[model samples]
Target: MKKYVYPSEISGTIAAPSSKSVMQRAIAASLLAEGESRITNPSFCDDSLAAMRVAEGLGAAVEKKSDSVIIRGGINPVTDTLNCGESGLCIRMFTPIAALTGKRMVLTGEGSLTSRPVSGIEGALGQLGVSVKSNNTLLPIEVSSILKGGTAAIDGSMSSQFLTGLLMALPLAEKDSVIKVDNLKSREYIDITIDVLKKFGIRVDNHGYNEFKIPGRQKYTSTDIAVEGDWSGAAFLLCAGAIAGSVSVTGLNSESCQPDRAVITALRKCGAGVTVEKNVIHVKSGSLRGFEFDATECPDLFPPLAALAFYCKGETVIWGAGRLKHKESDRGAAIISEFKKIGGTVKIDKDCMIIRGSSLTGGLTDSHGDHRMAMACAIAAMGSSDAVEIDHAECINKSYNEFYDDMIKLGAEIK
Candidate 1:
């Protein structure tokens, strides 16, 4: 799918997309509960659907309705193979959940997920007495033995997802489990995990993001959950408003543990007019200026921040390039390479990305099969002098299926 985005001033009210991150965890937790669980305003994005399919493959009866999903939870598996689509979260988070079954199971996925590392899944699960194997460090991870909870030390420098998997899985183990994490990144995501766990009647003692204690034999209780609006997806819409015109995005939680919610602070610091009240965030074009932001915890913000920097006056320096190497694409390189086609000056200095504000002359770029890269290019187009043609723009369906439509609704001339 190719997208042609013309420079246009956009103004309107748009509802933010539901958070697939939260939805996936809710589906996982719901699958563990022993009764019917209802998820309201559920996300049907590709990743969230993958998680729902994972839950079904694990023996949960899943039914999708107009506004909610009904899931009946159980641990019995009807399928020996669980396909996670292209979601990194599903593969990592579900690997441990799948191990709870004593029967052997094979977990696989498509696209970039097949190339992403799974050694951490193997090591972490192995230490907990689950027999695991992976295709080198990639997918096709196989677990043959039931997960036996015990003390384990995890290397958290790469990603906090492995720890999240352990945190979610250890509660159902046969014995109490202790997880000691070193150099944890994205601690906020762990907070989101804990929040979801609590809603499902599980308790995890988080000790300063370094240690976690989870009692085994813990059971999950099914209940109704309302999925929050996604800050990560909303960042693009908000950036579009900051660069082009006034736009009000509704449904985002001001208190969301999502780290990408920091984009609001970045907008305010860069001189964009911001009005925050309840779940609606109104952003208007203003005198934008360069600012420094550390995205070490919210690495997904890098792409939108790069787009936002194009309208700023000076130079914008964003830290945390190291966090992008393992994403759908080498996201750090993808952002720098694709944004340059639109006349944005972006360069990487060690682990920091430096963007110098300049007039944008939009041209052609590719999504590189990354949803955020596609949305970022579209946001940059709002301030461009020429149309921005994005190849593989449909990649946005991974998280925000209606991203272009929402932009069009906001008066962006995108086709």
Candidate 2:
């Protein structure tokens, strides 16, 4: 249980963490490339690591150098059981991908991931000729018989990540296929997947997130892949800069299609002075007034936005709290319990979280083994009466493994 007592203000040049989302996707792409891929500036986060293990289990040879990963694809099933740790993306995305291979593999997970439903996977994989079995759609999935490659209509309103895995894995099938989706949400995340697939020499005919055409027997051609920075994790640092002090976060692309890129709008609305140029976003503290934000499309931004709202005047209401129920933690409940430890007000009204921000009374805080919670608490401690103490602080490794080290570089006091 590491604790941190962050100072009132932080002023420094902080390099934004690498995008775990991009890194995980790249690993999957590399596995399909059937060649050596040079992935530079990769994330060692737990989710990314889980994706790596999945690729390795599929027979790809992966080697790490300095900060780059060299993956040579072409794998045979190494084990019948795979662990996704606590990565929702890895599980939702990989369940379909693992079915691409006929070998029977059981997908099991630990922690909060265990509670997430996997029954949808059984249905989706079944449509593609894979036999699926689950305990009421929960973890410990048993998938067998390689997909026959045909039309599969999937329900996408739940999570776009499941579709991403299917798109990536379907290319290797013996026959072309189409995925008809209904109520597809997070269209931006699908765009991110398509962009990454294009980099690896794969193509998907996207019909506005509702329909996708995947040409079978296509190959994933590898190239020099450099993953972009993470807007999700960067949201926290940018908000910290807006609330505590001036910060220059280098390596975020403003033109990115990441759903959480909407964080910039939240910052600007909260009265944070910001400048975005190319891959850099600079933020400085200013008069933080409470602002209402709609985070339905980019639900991951809830925690960071909540942290930003903690410094705003009056009450801050962020919509889309209902989308947070099945995340790494029950983020809705976790936010309320943890934020209250730092002396703030958090209430759940239907589908929104209202945080009344002022001067925070910092004390012991818990991360609840959630990556966002750990970073959000650290960010909230910026203007706290006392340095905030964080428990289960190591959870940041799930996304930004170097988060604590980077926070230290910005002059945080962690003990």
Candidate 3:
């Protein structure tokens, strides 16, 4: 699908979407809790749906409602194969959970996920006594043998997702486990995982982000919980408000542990009007100027940050380009290439992405099947000189299915 976004002044209020990160983790935890878990304000994005299907495949009964999900948790392997769709988190996090059943199963995914390397998963699970086989270190991973808890080590530079899987699955093992991690990134994501585990009555000891101790034979006690609003998704809306006009976003926890909350700092640094009160964040247009931000721990911010930078006065430097290679697309390259198509300047130098603020000429760009890329381009178009045409705009459904509608509600002229 293609979307045409014209320059417009947006003004209004909208509730932020539910966080898929939290929703998926909640689904995984519910599947292990052995009783009914009520998750309120759930996300129904494609990624969250994939996690729900995986939970059902593992023998959980999931009931979906308009605003919440009720899951009766238990793992019995109703299917021999689980399809995770295109969510990287679902495949990485559920592999260990699947191994807990000690039943031979294949964990696979579609689209970009199939090409992502799973060797880290194989190596990590092997150390715990689970037999893992993958397609040349890629997806379609086959796993057997129970996770017999023991000491294991993992290289965490690439992603913190596998560690999340280990942490979620380890407490159920017959023996206690120890995990020594090297070069862990996205530590905040680990914090989110631990927080969700606690809600499920699971415990894990963290040692300076390098090691984790898990006591075995722990049972997950189901409980009612509400999924937090996604800072990652809200960042784009906040950026939209920063560059165009006033926007007020509610449903966000001011104290969210999600790293993308750093968007608030970046916006303030760039001279955007920002006001925070309770769960509400209001951003309005200001004398925007380029600013520097370190995105090493919040790589997902790069796209929206780039959009915000496009309308600023000087130059914007965002650190952490190295983490963009393995996302839905080579996200850095996608941003640079697509932004250039719209008459914006962007370049990557080693580990940094630099953008020079200028008037966007407003032309055609492709989403490259990445949801963030699609949203970023759309947001950048909101202040452009002409209508910006985006290809594959449907990609937004991956994370924020209602993004375009929300923008429309905020007075953006889209066709």
Candidate 4:
């Protein structure tokens, strides 16, 4: 769905998308829960759907509704191999949970996730005594083991999803264990994991980002869960509001531990008029000043941050460029390339991206098959000479399936 967005000022209110990061973890917890569990505001994106399907395969009776899902837990492995679709998080997170059953399971995915590195999994699971077979950790991941849980030390510099998997699966083992991680990035995601596990009656001795201790033979209890609004997706809408006009986004908790919630902080630093109430986040266009942000724990914020940087009066610097290498595209580079095509100046030096604000001429931009990139381009339309012509724009379905339609509701000139 190639569409164009005319230069437009947007105003009004829109609800934030359900956090797929939260939703997927909720689904996994619900599946591990022993009884019927209902999750409100479940995400319906591609990655969320992949997690739902995995829940179904694992013996949970998953009923999807317009706003929620009922998961009757106790998985019975309906299929030999489970397809994780295009979600890197799903494959990595669910693989260890699958190992808990001591069943031989094959893991595969589509597109970038299939091509994304999985070398992290082979060694991590191997340390946990799970037998794995793979083509140098490039998909067709086969694992079977009794999963005698013990101490497994991991290098977490690459991704946090694998650690998320170990944390999820370790509790079900017959013996208590410890997972020692070094140089863990995305530690905010680990906070979410621990939060989800707590609701399911699992406790871990969290030694910051370095070590996690899990008690064995613990069974998860089913409970009602409410997914928080996604800061990653909301960052795009918030950018739309700040670049276009006054737009209010509801459903974000100001107290969220999710690192991407720092979008509000970055917005404040960029000089956007922002307000925080009980459950809603509000932002409006204002003269933005150049600001610096360390996105090491929230690399997903890069795209929207780039969009916001385009409207600033001077140069904006964002850290954590190294973490963008394994995303759908080289995200840091993709943001630079796409934004620069539309009259923005972007440069990469070491582990930072410098975006210089200017009068952007948004004639044409491409999403590079990255959903965040797609929304970033759409948000950049607020500063376009005319409507931004976006190619491969439909990739927004990866997280926010109704993004353009939602934008239309909030007065974005998207057609």
Q: Write the per-residue lDDT of candidate 3 for residues 1-415, one digit (tens) a residue.
A: 9999999899999999999999999999999998899999999999999999999999999999998999999999899999999999999999999999999999999988988899999988998999999999998999999999999999999899999999999999999999999999999999999999998889999999999999999999999999999999999999999989999999999898899999999999999999999999999999999999999999999999999999999999999999999999999999999999989999999999999998998999999999999999999999999999999999999999999999999999999
Model 1 residue 209 lDDT?
89
TM-score of each: 0.99, 0.97, 0.99, 0.98
- Give the count of colliding residue pairs in each prediction: 0, 4, 0, 6
Pairs with backbone N, CA or C atoms under 3 Å apart (clashes), candidate 4: 5-387, 5-388, 6-387, 7-386, 7-387, 58-75
lDDT (Cα, tens digit) per residue for candidate 2, span 1-415: 7767666577788778888888888988888777799899988888888989988887889898778999998757788888998998898777777887788889989887888887667787788888998878898888889877798988877688888888888888888999999888788989889999999989899987778999998888987789888999888888888877888889888998898989999999999999988788989999999999999889889988888898899899899887888788889999999888778898999988898975688888888888898899888887787888888888888898877777667666666
lDDT of 1 at 173: 95
Per-residue lDDT of candidate 1, residues 1-415 (tens digit):
9999999999999999999999999999999999999999899999999999999999999999979999999889999999999999999999999999987999999998999999877887888999998899888999988998999998888888878888888899999999999999999999999999999999999999889999999999999999999999999999999999999999999999999999999999899999999999999999999999999999999999999998999999999888999999999999888988888799999999999999999899999999999999999999899999999999999999999999999999998
lDDT of 4 by residue, 1-415 (tens): 7889878889998888999999999999899888999999989999999999987887889999998899999867898688898888899998988887788988888877877878878887898889988878699798897677998998899889999988888898889999999999988899999999999899988997899999998999999999999989999999888888988889999888788999988999999999999889889999889899999989999999888898899899999889999998889889878888889899889999898887889777888888989998888888778678999998899999999998888888888
Candidate 1, position 388, lDDT:
96
- Model 2 stretches with alpha carbons more than 4 Å out: none
Q: Go through the candidates in order and give each one's C-alpha lDDT.
A: 0.93, 0.85, 0.96, 0.88
Once all C-alphas are superposed, what RMSD does model 1 give against the true structure? 0.8
lDDT of 3 at 348: 100
